[model samples]
Target: MAALPRQQHPDLLVGLETADDAGVYRLTPEIALIQTVDFFTPIVNDPYLFGQIAAANALSDVYAMGGKPLTAMNILCVSLKMVAKETLQAILTGGMDKIHEAGALLVGGHSVEDPELKYGLSVTGIVHPDRVLANSGARMGDALILTKPLGTGILATASKGRLATPEMEAGMAEVMRTLNRIPEDILIAGHIHAATDITGFGFFGHALEMARGSQVTMTLFASRIPILAAAREFALMGLIPAGSFANRRFCERHLQTAPGIDPLILDLLSDAQTNGGLLLAAAPQAAQGIVTRFQEEGCPAAALVGEITAPGKGIIRVEA
Candidate 1:
């Protein structure tokens, strides 16, 4: 993507420059369009649930950009000869349900036959031109709040290996299918400086992007990060995903960990998440309140996990 010629225009609010969650283009003086697309092969056994998770994950990019999704189109890839007709219908139905839940219309879509089944959406949303949120605006003294727990990658690996308990599977499914929609009242009250959804990059990977983009160092309290209880056990059992290791390697040079920090915790931090929560950098004074409201609104795992410290070249410092 870096090799592609950079498109410069007066209305391009957010582009490929910062690797933000979505592309924003100003349509008018008051409104801007947020566009993003994501699709992946099955991560769960149930086709319906997989569809819901994929749609939610794709829609999350718009939400992370502080936009409200207005419409979505299905992106499907499957082998018609190999997949059952009922299964395909279930997947489409599931995606439609989530799109409606987000108050967005599913107007149309395109599909193709492939060796593997894949599903997701192409979402278009709108936001105030002045209020577009990008991953590059985090300021020093801002509190980092994560809206969901970590460890989905490890749990999924354990499930694939048949080592995960039923409870663990259920927990992982719930986290993946849940949407990261922040209420309007909280958005207005939180004074968010920057935001991004935790997805394929893992928590540390995305946070590193924010730190680098804002040109500041981030200090994380390892103990404060929320993790699914079973993830630690699975990670210790060596059920970590290959993506987790790659994410760690990608961020290691810029990462600084304090002595005595648990290796298992670091593994969990680097675990690649599917359809994870929104990580918001908010004003310090209102950070706790925003978290409280998130908890009250059914996001029980939401917590303040870190903060921007000082000017730096995208370095992350983790403490026990």
Candidate 2:
């Protein structure tokens, strides 16, 4: 963004300015390729589970933008001397299963030897230019909706060294492995104005980006935020992760905190989500319908977390 060097092609429509879910390069006035690639090291210990989480996280970008994933190429970095082939196979199997579940074809994939294990997908999805969802269109009075409970990052951190409890691990794993497909159908049906998937950036970080990108402010109600019960209980026990701190730092300037609510709640909001759900800004009337639709689609964690407000006041306000 510093300077669009000379050879850069000018885009007639929106693309990178909004910190969108994915990069849209228009092929024509009618169609655009929504491309996104996200890869990371194992978040969980089980190779198979790690792969599933990674695949779900990677494909979420396309879904967030109201695009259906059509095809994908597997990306793998394996440590040949460091791990057994069986472990790698489990990882691949996990990813393949998720890709199939998403209705996206895993036509081919690439694997290379490396010092650390990494796996994800480089996905391509198709969408009509006119039907694409964007983050810049969020309006005042729009109710903010979150489709998944927060705090996956906290559990994952505790999951390391067997520090995580059975209930805690089960809850985070369940949410992280769950796909955000429920919201995609909602987006395609039209009415959703702005949307973004939560990942390493945490909810507040991404919400701030949407607000700043749209030149608006978001007022979040802490009491109503749908967070896994374990997230709060464990957070008080100092089960916070390194990424949580990073997330807090990233959104600290744009966030407004209140007392009586333990500071641990911020840790929950800033918790680095792996394959977190969608945070949508849409008309107030649509909020209840969207939440209900998500419940019908098996995402009971979805809820109306807050509302978008006017600009210059603040990007986010976390109630007491």
Candidate 3:
């Protein structure tokens, strides 16, 4: 995309340049529009639950950009012959449930017959022009907070291998279904310097993006990082997905691990995520307050996992 020449407009606040979660266009001095779209093949067995996860994942980009989702349009690709009519209806119904939960209207949708089943949404949201948050403004000494535990990628892989237990599958589903709406709204008005959702690229990958984009190094406390319950166990059992290994390789050259740090833990850190939570870089003075409020508002898993360091080689230090 960087090599491609595209016309630029002053009203376009964010486009492909920064690799931001969404496209932000300033409609007026007070209001900006956030647009993002995402869809993927079913990760869970139940079509309804799969729809819910896909919708949540799609809406997450808007939340990561500190925008209030106002509406969404469905994007579906299904194998009509292989899927029952009720299953398709259930999928749309599930997505509608989440759209409503986000207080967004389901305006319309598009569908196509395909060999594989898939679903998601194209979400449009609104945010104050002055409050638009990007993943590139993190500063030195800023504290990093992760609002959800990692491990969905590993658990999902385990499910395909028939290694994940029913409890574990349920847990992963619950995490994916939950939106980042709470933290996004709560911290957007706070001292947050930068933010990004931990999704396909994983925590380490996205954090690396933050650091590199801000021209700073980061030190993450391995012990302080939150992991999904049973995620480590699944990872230890070698249930990691192909994407996880790819993530590790993609970011390894830019990472520095302390001596004796467990390899398994590193693998979990690089584990690709689906519908993960927000990773916020907050000013030190406001970090604790924001975290306290997030937890008090029912986001108990939220934690201060790391901090930004002075500009350097964009290396991420993992300290045990």
Candidate 4:
């Protein structure tokens, strides 16, 4: 908050210190430009799917602000010696396909030689100034809804199992490889208020981000929070990813566990995600409608997990 030009600009909705998705620059009294960029190593072994997920993740920051992704430029870091040039081509092609799907054009790109392949996009998007959703817009009574299921971390770990089953791989791949576009669509359609995509931070870390950003306390029902079927097995198999530890370190201060809570279930809440979905804060009337909207869009797992309270200074509690 201290780093931004908030003193000079009044319309900067959210920036470096607020934990918001993108930095919004007001173009006019009624229009704003949203900008965000991201790139990460492939979360999965499939180069093409990795490209697609990377593009989606990068674009998600814009959508998290209820903005439309209008354009992007590819960002690549490739190892010319280790991986074949063809793999990089397929990777870029996959990213291009997703950008095209979102009606965003890739005008150009830059590449660098490295030891490993890294790909994503630098996305630019547009939104009406008044309609821009900031993480702080969440009200005390706003309902909390998660647009996707948790467990990508555990599942991905399970995928590395020596006896990894085809079914398990299929499940984890679909979750990690998919985009958060639908939740963005719903938010843009005015079905939600504040929105944020859950990615590397995992579900609880992101929840803490929103709670702290909004200066509100959030109470979530453990039973209602959705999880993948394979997460438990993965945890039992000790397949948790490294990011899980980071998430816990950063977010542990705000979380409050309930009695008899399964430790693995707790871990799932901290597991890192790839192309995760949006967590929306909306009014109750709009909350049910939002769930229905996701379901109609074929997202049955979408759930209203909790609600916000008066600003509790920071993340308040995470209980069953």
Task: Give the per-residue lDDT of model 3 (tens digit) for 1-320.
Answer: 78977759988988998878999999999999999999999999988899899999999999888889999999999888999999999999999999999999999999999988889999999988888779998999999998888999999998998888898899899889888785555645658888899999988899988888888999999998889878898888888989889999999999999999998988999999999988999999888888887777656788999999778757899999
TM-score ranking of the models:
1, 3, 2, 4
Backbone clash pairs in model 1 (N, Cα, C under 3 Å; residues 3+ apart or in different chains), count: 0
Cα lDDT tens digits for candidate 4, 1-320: 56655444687766677778888988888779999999988777778888888898898888788888999999999878888878888899989988988779998989999887789899999888878877766788889988778888777776666545777766767765555665555555674668898888899888887887777888887788878887877777778888897887777777777777776767888889886778889987788888877766646688998988667865646566
Best by TM-score: 1
Tell me the TM-score of each prediction against the true structure: 0.98, 0.92, 0.96, 0.91
Show the colliding residue pairs in model 4: none
Q: State which candidate, 1 or 4, has the greater TM-score.
A: 1
- lDDT (10s digit) by residue, model 2, range 1-320: 62653333544245555568787767788787888888889887779888888888888898887788889899998879998989988988998899999898898988898998899999998777877777677888999999999988777766775777777777787788787885566666677888889887899888887888778878889988898876676688887878788989989988877667677778889988898989988889878999999878868889999888676544787885
State residue 61's C-alpha deviation in candidate 2, in Å.
0.7
* True lDDT of residue 77, candidate 4: 91
| True-structure RMSD for candidate 2 | 2.2
Better of 3 and 4 by lDDT: 3
lDDT of 4 at 265: 66
Separate clash counts for every candidate = 0, 0, 0, 0
Worst 10-residue stretch by lDDT in candidate 1? Answer: 181-190
Error of 1 at 8 (Å): 0.3
The segments of candidate 1 whose C-alpha lies over 4 angstroms from its true place after superposition are none
